[model samples]
Target: MLVLGIESSCDETGIALYCTRRGLLAHALHTQMAMHAEYGGVVPELASRDHIRRLVPLTQSCLKDAGADFADIDAVAYTQGPGLGGALLAGASYANALAFALDKPVLPLHHLEGHLLSPLLTDEGVDFPFVALLVSGGHTQFMAVHGVGDYVLLGETVDDAAGEAFDKTAKLLGLPYPGGAKLSELAELGTPDAYRFPRPMLHSGDLNMSFSGLKTAVLTAVEKARAEHGGSLPESVRNDICRAFQDAVADVLAAKAAAALRQTGLRTLVVAGGVGANRQLRQRLCALTIGKEAVQTFFPPPALCTDNGAMMAFAGAMRLRHGVQAAAPAGAFTVRPRWPLAQLSP
Candidate 1:
């Protein structure tokens, strides 16, 4: 089966083609980071408009790269929700319209599910019945994955996702928009233990976590540093703070991942979402061990770490391969901007 996947959940427009027999054929993406950076964050209206502009050209590019035509598509899969409503609508409407033109079935996929299943796109042999740590800009949660479409909520953030905290903390430290990645880059130059930050909910005796308190702790430290430096934070001090903040997040996530593995008696840990690309977090997760058994961690390729069409395509193919029903037709469709991963039916 040939499936075309469209992803416009937020600031990126991604399009791809996947074949059950050939794996991912080709994928194209256009990120609005540079545009959104000028505004300090994404403007939903702009994001939606960009998606509308990029979808057709990107799809054509993907098809050209794949050496396929639109007529070859057997099914169309697209992110249905859990994102900016306008952004989701842009992709959904385009996908439905295209599928209707081609007379192909449509698959309304969950955005988080696309991320959760992305590791399978690689050749590393990630299997089912594993614990998934889905950490991204919008969400941070642990899930118990029994199989495709069978996911159980393990734990999640009570407030402020890890990536959100990273960006917010970076902004507090005078970094630019989309500060999470920049903060991580600076962390590499920082001194360990120079300015330790709090690890919120590290020992709450449950899987649920919190990062809002950690962000406040960083704010407090930043204020103190600025006050001591005559209202200006030194570059070295900023890097040290970044290191401490990254370390704190890495430590807490590592500990919780281990606990989840132990609780479920699962050794495979699949890390997904943008934060899965973090150097410190990857190091911590790679070295994770529960009791005497070492945990096996899987991550999508760096390019696939962020939102993209390939994950959606691959996920849709997997569902179809497993006999999940596709939408009857693309006559009338709607987007769900706030759909939960747990709401998916097995």
Candidate 2:
């Protein structure tokens, strides 16, 4: 079966074709990060409008890349919930309309589920009952997974997500918006012990985490350095602060992840979402799990770690193979801005 996926949940417009027998055939994406950078964040209205303009063309390009045509598509999958209403609608409307015209089924996918399942698309060793750590711009969550669609929330951030913390802290340092990756790059040049930031709730003894306070702590550090220096904080000092901040986040995440693994007794750890792209976090996670204790660590290639349509297509294909019904014809449906992924089934 062939599934064409559409994703416009945020500032990216992604389209892809996933063939059950052949794997991912084609995928196209346009990130609005640079466009929204001037404003320091995503503009929902602008994001939605851009999706409207890009969806059709992107689908066409994906089809061409796959060497397939609309007639070859068996089903259409689109991100349907847990996103900005307007943005979701853009993809939803297009997917539904196309499915109706093609006389094909529509698959309404949960965005987070796509992220959770992403690691499986490439990693051959991943299996059921993995511990999931999804760290994105908008979400930081841990789940206990037992096979496809069987997800139980283990713990999550109570405030800002890890990616958000990175960006916010970077912003405070005069870095560009959407600065998470940039912040991480700078941290690589910094001395690991030059500064120390708290690892919040590291020993709280529960899965729940708090990162907003961690961000505030970074702000406090920046302020103290500026005040003490009488004008500007040195570049090395800023890099040190970045290093300390990244360390705090990586430590908290790594510690919590190990805890989740111990608590669930799951041997597989799959990291997804944007923040999963962090080199230090990857190093820490690998250091903790790799080549020891039967624990397997899997991460998508950096590009796939972020939001995209390929994961949606792959997830939809998984559902189709498992006998889940395709989405209803699109014009009659609505996006669930806050759907709980655990509510889905395989």
Candidate 3:
């Protein structure tokens, strides 16, 4: 089956084509990071407008790269919810209209489910019945995956997600917008012991975690450093803070992932979402083990870690392959900007 996927959940507009027999044919993406950076963060109105501008060209580009045409697409799949209402609508309306035009069925996929299932796109070894650690800018949670469309929430953040904390902390240290990745880059140059930050909910005896407290701790440390440096933080000191902050987040995630594995007796861990691309987090997860058995960890390629059309396309194809019913094309449709992953039915 040939499935075309559209992703406009947030600041990125992604489009792709996937074939059940041939895997991912091609994908195209346009990120609004540069534009949003000027505003210190994503402005939803701008993001929605950009999606409208990019979707058609990107879809054409993807089709050209795949050597396919609109008539060849067997189904249309798109992110339906759990994102900016406008952004989701941009993709959803396009997908539904396209599907209606082609007389193809539409598969409205859950955004987080795309992230959770992304690893399967490349890793042939990862099977069903695994634990998933979804750490992204908007969310951080652990889920027990039994199969496609079968997910159980294991635990999640009580407050800010790990990636949000990273960005917020980076901003505190005078980094630019979209500061998470930059903070990580500077962390590589940091001294490990130069600073220490609290690891919130590390031993709360449950899978739930928290990072808001950690962000506050970083703020406190930054204030102290600025005071000592005569109201200016030294570059070296900033790097040190970055390292400590990254280390703390990595530790918390690694520990909770291990705990989830222990609780579920599932040794396979699939890490997805943007923060899953963190080199430090990857290193820790790669080396993680529970008791005597080493855990097998899987990550989507770095490019796929963020919101993208490839994951959405791949996810939609998987659903059709697995027997999930696709909605017939219709004139009217609605989007759920706050849909919960747990509410998805098999």
Candidate 4:
């Protein structure tokens, strides 16, 4: 079966083609980061417009790279939501229109599910019944995965997500837009223990987390440093703060992941979403030993770590392989701005 996936849940427009027998044939992505950078954040209107401009060309690019024709695509899959409504609509409309044109069935997939299942695209040896730590710009949660469409909510953030905190904290430290990656890079130059940020809810006796307070703590520290440094923070001081912040987040996530594994009695841990690409987090997880057994962690490739269509394509193919049928022909389609991953059933 061949599934063409379209992702426009947010600022990125991703298109891909996946063949069940051949794995991912090809994928193309166009991030609106540079455009949104000027605004210090994404503007929904701009994002939606960019998706309109990129989707068709990107899909064509994917087909060209795969050496496949539109007739070869058997199904069309798109992110059904948990994102900007306008952006979601762009992808949904395009996907449904394409499916209708090709007389192919449409599959409305949950965006988070796409991210959760992405690691499987590369690690073919990974089986079901694993623990998943999904941390991204808008979501931070732990889930127990029994199989495709079978996910149980383990825990989630009670406040700001880890990625949100990273971006907000970076902004507070005078970093540019899309600050999370820059913050992480600066952290590498920081001296160990020069600064130590709070690890919020690291021991609340549950899987739920809190990072909003951590961002406030960073603000407080930044204010103090500015006041002490005559209203200007030194470069070294900023780097140390970034390092402290990253360390705290890494420590909290790594500890919670280990706990989740122990609680579920699962040794295989899959990390997904943009924040899952954190080098420090990956390193910490790789070193984790749950109880006496070492934990095995899996992550999608760097390109797949962020929002992309290939995950949706691969996930759709998996569902099809599991006997889940695509949507019947319809006159109109809608997208979900907020949908729970647990709502999907096997």
Return the clash pairs for model 3, or none.
none
| Model 2: ten consecutive residues of lowest lDDT | 322-331
lDDT for each residue of candidate 1 in 113-210, tens digit (9 for 90 to 100): 99999999985488888999999999999999998899999999999999999999999998999999999999999999998788888998999999
Whole-model Cα lDDT per candidate? 0.93, 0.89, 0.93, 0.92
Task: lDDT for model 3, please.
Answer: 0.93
Residue 313 CA displacement from its true place in model 4, Å:
0.5
- Candidate 3 Cα errors over 4 Å, as ranges: none
Which lDDT tens digits does candidate 2 get at residues 4-64?
9889898999998999999999899999988899899999999999999999899999988
- What lDDT is reached at residue 251 by model 4? 92
Model 2 alpha-carbon drift over 4 Å, by segment: 289-292
lDDT per residue for candidate 3 within 150-225, as digits (tens), equals 9899899999988999899889888999999999999999999788888889999999999999878889999998
Higher-lDDT candidate among 2 and 4?
A: 4
The alpha-carbon deviation from the true structure for residue 97 of candidate 2, after best TM-score superposition, in angstroms, is 1.0
The per-residue C-alpha lDDT of model 3 at residue 85 equals: 97
Provide the TM-score for each candidate, comma-separated: 0.99, 0.97, 0.99, 0.98
lDDT of 1: 0.93
